[model samples]
Target: MNYAYLSSLFRKQTGKSITAYKNELLIEQAIDIFKKSNKNITEVSNKLGFSNPYYFSRVFKRVTGVSPSVYLSQIYRN
Candidate 1:
């Protein structure tokens, strides 16, 4: 891999850069799976390679301002 050349390719037009973009992607996908899956927290965490459910819940809540179960409940009621 040409590290320098690839690095230049990912220098975001908005100045956020590639790492930030990838993080946004991860957080976005997490929400997608959370809403779509009937899987439990541990399953979501494991599926997403989050190491543990506690940390997964923490990150999910941080991004969406609610627990995964709570989030799922809202969707289910609608």
Candidate 2:
């Protein structure tokens, strides 16, 4: 469950560290859930292993340039 060296190994391969790669993947999943699933913000946050909705929202917005609710609304309205 712990991958301290994967960062170095992945960085050596793709020039992107594990932390960055993992965060990118996590953010992508969050977007999928927000746009394609019935899960609420809190539920998606918990399912993604985030500490809480606030923390998840912070990270989600930081990565996607928008809030989870706003993203979800865009999908829902479309």
Candidate 3:
């Protein structure tokens, strides 16, 4: 019920911190949104609950190893 207990359970079940799981979920949502819409990175970032596109891009690249723009470009190239 508390933060510490929940964090422990999360680590035990998934081997990742809660923040990492949330970011992974957000990035997955962002990828789906990006693939479905023609909106720019800022729009996609905002839709995924990020206040700043720059921060969103950093997180996206960290999780995905590529920026949102680059991801979309690759999709287009295929």
Candidate 4:
């Protein structure tokens, strides 16, 4: 019925907070964008509504276990 209750239910169901879930989804999108386009990390971060590229990089690393630059390098290397 309320935001906190819904958030609690979501966490119980998904084992992650809403913010974590959102960051994960955003990172997934970032990967897709990286693979499909020539957009740089800053561009992708802005497209995904991150406040800044640095914060986006932090969240991206937190979700994917690598920085955006490293992820891009890995993606292109494979």
Candidate 2: C-alpha RMSD after superposition: 2.8
Which residue runs of candidate 3 sit more than 4 Å off their true CA positions?
none
Residues 41-69, model 2: lDDT tens digits: 89998999988899888888878899988
Best candidate (score: lDDT): 4
Question: Each model's TM-score?
Answer: 0.64, 0.75, 0.92, 0.95
TM-score of 3: 0.92
For all predictions, the C-alpha RMSD in Å is 3.1, 2.8, 0.9, 0.8
lDDT of 3 at 32: 89
Q: What lDDT does model 2 reach?
A: 0.83
1-78: candidate 1 lDDT, tens digit per residue: 797767677784556556556656666887788677777778878887887888878777876788888987888899
Count of clashing pairs, candidate 2: 0
Candidate 4, number of clashes: 0
Query: Which residue pairs in model 4 clash with each other?
Result: none
Instruction: Give lDDT tens digits, candidate 4, residues 1-78.
Output: 999999999999999999999999999999999999999999999999999999999999999899999998998899
Which residue pairs in candidate 3 have backbone atoms (N, alpha carbon, C) closer than 3 angstroms, thus clashing?
A: none
Residue 51, model 1, lDDT: 76
